[model samples]
Target: MIEQVTVTPIAPPPAVPRASTWAAELRATFTLAWPLVIAQLAQNALTTTDVIMTGWLGPEFLAAGTLASTFLMPFLVGGMGIVGAVAPLVAQARGARDIKAVRRVVRQGMWASIVIAALLVPILWQIKPIFAALGQNPDTTLMAEQYIQIGVWMLFPALAIIALRSLLSAFDSTRIILLITIGGVLFNALVNYALIFGNFGFPRLELRGSAVATVLTNLLMFGLMLTYVLRHRRFKRFNIMIRFWKPDWPRFREIFRIGTPIGLTVLSEVGLFTAAALLMGLLGTDEIAAHAVALQCASMAFMVPLGLGTAATVRVGVAYGRKDAEGVRKAGWTAFALGTGFMTLTCILFLTAGPLIVSWFLDPRSPANANALGLAATFLVVAGFFQIVDGAQVVAAHALRGLSDTKVPMIMAIIGYWFIGLPIAYVLGLVLDWRGVGIWLGLAAGLGIVAVVLVARFAMRKRLGLMAGLG
Candidate 1:
């Protein structure tokens, strides 16, 4: 009775909004995306450097690197796709302020990446025999085998790095990834010098040396990223490091639920391209060589929008977390606009300076260069048309990912690539004898169709309130 007059303290209210949600979404999207874009650019530069250095060895070495990369690519690219499953999931968890779910996702993603690397390494290791069975030249096969074997070892580290990057991206800390990628590229260049040419008192290993350099650099990157994440104050708060060491079955299952379809979707697209290369090889070495050059160039261009797409996912995820459907729509459209603008500019550059660009990797003055350059130029021109559409599609896909609708996009990709795209490419490239250009045209068709369908699906979902809680 005597203490009845005691007063209870009231808690302060949450901070009021400072800006329009659309404005906030735009700022956050760029803040998250620019670093990722820079990181992607650096990674591409690393591969470009490898190609440039190998170009010095002669066409056979360059061709071997290209072939080996294409064959080994599904492991790395496809694995990254699987890891990509983590981002949207983490993003949504972050939005919900569910610290537990976030930590669980990080751990499960690490495990999934390990499994992916394990399954892929053996398949890549035995690729030499497969190439031989496919009638690849003995010289190309020998060089490719050496490169593939060493490169395959790097898959473990690459997968780890990819897993780390995806988690970081979800947290909107892309600067860390950018910094590490820049370091990796520089390290790769130095290692390549020492290993490829026997510098620094090391034995010259040539092509195999290049592979060794790549493996060492990737391992270094993974170590550095892991160390940084563990020590960083920001990341430590989320227990990303701790949870990564402990297995969480429920979280792992959630990751698989979201990730498997994405992995298969990516696998299907990459498989189609790989199949195209194999079929092109059947046509002749020159065709294969030309295809390799064009493919490399296109891959480089594709990374720009790919980075944008990553940013789009983060933006959409953040918006979804805020439970703002309108914000999500605005962010998605803004990303599409930015991506399309960048890719359209790229198209103009490719049209005007394609020959110059191809010459950087392939010497037109060389006797074997004429055909390759000529065909590459043609492919680049055709590639120009699709780049914008490709960017749009990727951004749209990311929007869907933010909505946690991975299954739908996966289905669309499967239909777009296999049911629609690959058949068209085969008919044109092989049956009608349109060659590499034909294959590219088919790719354009598939990507365009995907762009339309995915964007429409996202629109429908938003309009129908299907994305209410997913915000």
Candidate 2:
């Protein structure tokens, strides 16, 4: 027996687990975020072009355009937010490798988009009286009404783009989305230039030209995106449009269930800004025009975070679907980091170069533009102060959205924006006679409040049971 003793072979060492690093997470987040950022910037450039051209027409046209946007954006953003649910839904489906679910959700999203646009378009048609009811300037209201009447046609296509873009984003085909949007920007500029100034043998349409250009650009974008989605090998396999007229009531309702709160969440924040525009209107035309210029600058910078936020929604949604809590955490915090970092750069630019940036919107040398330009520069400085909070809040809200958490954030938005932010704006701007600067400070306060609450909520997700079901 002693001579027959056998030697035991050495056991293989246990496999070492690969840990995720901040560098890897950052690279992954940036890869997903960059295309979206470019797409968002290009999309915003469409509006910026309209703003630049309208500003060239004079302060009145600029004021009218701002008023029109104030009315239109709430409707558009709310509807788009509803449809935006498609993104996280599709993202989760992909994570689970449920291709059929992806098709069903996207189809229903299209149906939802159509229905939302149809209902909202009519309401948007009544902008004149609505503005009047809100006590906006009569002249500006009339002009805005004209612009909206023509621009309303863009809604159907616009909402459609959101649904389609949601699909593309889920598939990580956002490069095409960026290209298509860039094309829309170029086309919008050319059409606006030709029709606005009556160049290239086209009759001048002025504000109406901008409206027509907007409609055409949206249609072109929708067409191009639809074509790509239908033909692209990566996406065509899903056959998203196979049963075009079929009803999927549950998915459609699910879109609204998850989305209505999202829409209202958007309405809450955008509505706050719109109300601020109305407040500026009360101050005077120059105030409103200046607000428009400064707001556009802020909005342009905002697109970066907005795009990053969207990417976070998809990334975190995928991770959540896979029940990978660590992945979700990495994806989410990475987005917050990138978004806030970019916003820091923008904050410095706005603070240091406020006057120069304002001049790009209005001719600094012109006596007519002097007052508006000065006000715009001042507003930009104020906008700079809120940049970090603004970026953080939007990204945090989107991170929650990835977890399919909408209702609470919606409530938070209402409390922060409407309940807290608006009252401060009214008191400081009106009651205290702080006027324009006061209004901006109030906006900053609201954004800061929401940011704190949202960031806190996200940070405490696991401890608060938000990640209970997730691994």
Cα RMSD for candidates in order: 6.2, 8.6
lDDT of each candidate versus the true structure? 0.78, 0.89
lDDT of 1 by residue, 342-455 (tens): 999988988888888878877788887788778778888888888888888888888878777788788989999889988999899889989888888888888888889988
Work out candidate 1's RMSD over C-alphas.
6.2
User: Which lDDT value does model 1 have at 6?
Assistant: 18
Error of 1 at 252 (Å): 0.7
In candidate 2, what are the lDDT values of residues 1-471, reduced to their tens digit? 001112232332222122288787787778778999999999999999999999999999999999998889999999999999999887776666667777888999999989999998889998987888888889989989889999999989999899999989876778999999999999999999998889999998888999999999999999999999899877787788897899988788888988898999989999999999999999999999999999999999999999999998988887776677898898889999999999999999999999998999888888999999999999999999999999999999999888888888999999999999999999999999999999999999999999999999999988877786776
Clashing pairs in 2: none
TM per candidate comes to: 0.92, 0.95
